[model samples]
Target: MKPADSAAVALLGLTVLGLAAPTAAAQVEPDPMVAGQRVRISDGRRCAQDGAARVSSRLFGPVVLRPGEGGMAAQARVAEGAAPGRYPVTIHCASGGASFTETVTVRDARVEGLNAAQAAGGLALLALAAGAAFWLRRTVGGRS
Candidate 1:
């Protein structure tokens, strides 16, 4: 083939691949999940076939991924007494015929609660100061 024709063919092939990329991307589902939460996996068109969902976790060995409508679902359970951190979770499926790595974050509920409480307390303190300032301005200006 002529050089110009070959270049045109290459360009056409790239364009086609780019157009089909989104369909392939739809095959991968949710990622960066919270520990112990069930999340779904997708190959875009349908759920993983039976006995096709396999999961491996750094902290929890051999996690089970159940087949569900549209995809496969798996819950990355944090190990008992494990500290809060990011852990790797690997998912394998037949539809995509590939493995994907997602991170599961294990956070202590108590710590989250405490952080929330601290934020609320700070907001309350600011509100109180604003109110006090407004009161002082009214009283002092009335005397002037």
Candidate 2:
């Protein structure tokens, strides 16, 4: 092969290897989490051997992260009044390791239509009204 062609091949191989290199990333489980719910954040790389790392976000506030299987894991409870939107979560290692950001989605807990409790209550009221009508009909008819 020509020198120029070999050089080009080497450059292409290097570029591919660089692109395939693994990078430390952070991710949140249960992407669309309801407000007041807890979510698990997983770290792709372990933090330095120092104190605990800090995980903070507008939805969940600051939480101390600990090293777990595969990487660091922490559970954060989203605020009860968090608005329905996407929030950025940040993980800062204690010993100045790489910091990464991940996004978490928060959704309103209340459903748009009637919920189970409301449906049950409505059924109870309906039954009571039916019973009252039956009693009135029986009593008035018997008297007449």
Clashes of each: 2, 0
Q: How do the residues 38-114 of candidate 2 rate in per-residue lDDT, one tens digit apiece?
A: 77887766576456788878887778888777577788888888999888888888878778898766767643566
lDDT of 2: 0.73
Q: Write the per-residue lDDT of candidate 1 for residues 48-111, one digit (tens) a residue.
A: 4666566666656575566666556554444565567776666676556677665645565532
Clashing pairs in 1: 27-42, 27-43
Model 2 misplaced stretches (Cα beyond 4 Å): 1-24, 109-144
lDDT of each: 0.55, 0.73
Identify the leading candidate in terms of lDDT.
2
lDDT of 1 at 81: 59
In lDDT terms, how accurate is model 1?
Answer: 0.55
